[model samples]
Target: MTAAVTTEHREHYLALVGHGDEAAAVDYALGLAECGVSPRDLVLDLIGPTQRRIGDLWARDEWSVAQEHAATHVSEQVVAALAARHRPRPDRGVVVVACVDGEWHALPARLFAEVIRWDGWDVRFLGASVPGPHLVSYLHRHGPDVVAVSCSVPTRLTSAHRVIQAVQDVGVPVLAGGGGFGPGARWGTKLGADRVAADGRAALEVLRSWPLRAVAEVSPLRDSFVSDDEHVLVVKRGAQLVAVAMDRLADRFPAVHGYTAAQREATEYDLGQIVEFLCAGLFVDDVELFRAFVSWLCVVLASRRVPPETVDLVLDVYHDELFDFPRARAHLVAGRRQVPAGRQVAA
Candidate 1:
């Protein structure tokens, strides 16, 4: 049965976890569970929101990385405590939950696994970043009803396609989730996944209705589609791209020019993400994948008091560097469109 989660209850859990009070947070969640609040609500309502808030706090500079990591640890403890008290009914069929290769954000996948287990499905939670070969071997051995693939970052979409194809080759259907799959599961469908779930509840609904079938020969999408030499070329030159962009940004923007070693490294990391997401967008043949990331990057830069035009400068640098690659140039053009024209640095 689904339990009601009051706003007060939600805020209470957030306060406990945010303060690094893992014991109190775990106790508070367990208390709610004992009161009959569904484990699903505990995950989706309390812990899930808290995790997002942690990221928001860090992005706004209100919380340090240490604080974010500590808060995440607290949330993990709460989930662990909840899983210990609740036992699966075992009447529902088996499901395997795992993060795609190269995806380290395992909390969402962990929460989804526990919620599915509480909903009566037998779950084998394979933690984070399960390699393709190992995952296929596990599926062959256990043969679960469905596989839930979780991805949190857009950069991992290429790896996700590989995982989706690998699981499908063994005749197992995949339900892709996480922000990495892109808004509305756009990339998931393009990657040829059987289904996509926006959240834990939606994942459960899809799993319930999924059709079972025998293992058959499922052809891989990568082979059928035209070769993605553009993606490969961009990825192969990722380091050079970041290096050149970093040097150019420092020359073009005073803020970047005066950055400390740590700040320069951060700038380098951002440039690297731009290149990676660009490649990922190319891989999926979708402009929105790169566009969405640029939009979000603008917001993050604004939060840090950096001019969003810095993103424009980086895009311009890439345009000059990759002029030979028309497809890459086109994706960069789409990304630059998302940023506003005026350059106003936050003070």
Candidate 2:
């Protein structure tokens, strides 16, 4: 039987929020509405709080990618249904919401758009991965009153500055907000942004104030340590695109020289002097493998309760599979270090 949408629904909503369960969140919202919870209260108390919980869970690593997607989807549905139920307010102007190029995370933007819409402002959700030129064209054509740009990763911050320039060129005020701006309150200021909201609700409050002006002067792009080395492989994992430096791998793991020519030719591990490598899909690149291997070695060195079978398994499989593993292990043993037994080592 389906669970009744009662005060009990709040608990389920909380779970959906914490885990990013979209479908369950929608159902919870429906129940809350049936139980006579006003949309205004639902937005302020339920939806807002739920997003905060999702952020917390993400920080704690308690939620998976699937869970976060589910939560975001359900929250979107809730916003849509609520908007349909409420008559449009005539007072406020339109907002153009987007993420900067290379910044593909959009849940925060979507959530803020909904909250602003609920507060009587019209919103144009540009979704994720919007290019700067496209946004400039969009602003030129549509002429939204406010532009909201989000970037969760610090890596894409340089691209974000370009987005700000594009929007400002079209004479629209921009509201920049998200995880990236929280650490340094001066982040937006440094970027020459009009206003920086601490969060979604704070953004809404800033927009409502109306008197806040966006700076007109253009700013230079922020510094990026990410180099254009071809040996550098960039891989996207959710909102972050981690860059791996493979150029220094050989010096770090000189035992790689011990591999047979056949082994060297067959495995990607032998791409000598690799500057960058990506960690895309299921398989990890050589950089991540090395990092994981080192961390595993650390745990084995520290933990005493590891099983003998696990240690034997590591010696049998990894020692044979990796050309450098045997030499590395020998080095560790020579240092009088004891390795722990384990099935899978944490990285």
Per-candidate TM-score against the hidden true structure: 0.91, 0.58
| lDDT for each candidate structure | 0.83, 0.56
In angstroms, what RMSD does candidate 2 have relative to the true structure?
11.2
lDDT of 2 at 288: 31
lDDT by residue for model 2 (1-347), tens: 22233445556687765566556667767666767776756775676666666655654456665776677677767877776776567468888889888777776677677778778887788999898888888888898887888877544555766787767777787778876543433456556677788766677677887653444432343222232322122222211211111212234456546758775453233121110111210111123323333344444323434334433333333323333333323322322223333344322
- All models, RMSD in angstroms: 3.5, 11.2
Query: Which clashing pairs does model 1 show?
Result: none
Residue by residue across 114-137, what tens digits does model 1's lDDT show? 988888889999989999999999
Residue-level lDDT for 294 in candidate 1: 87
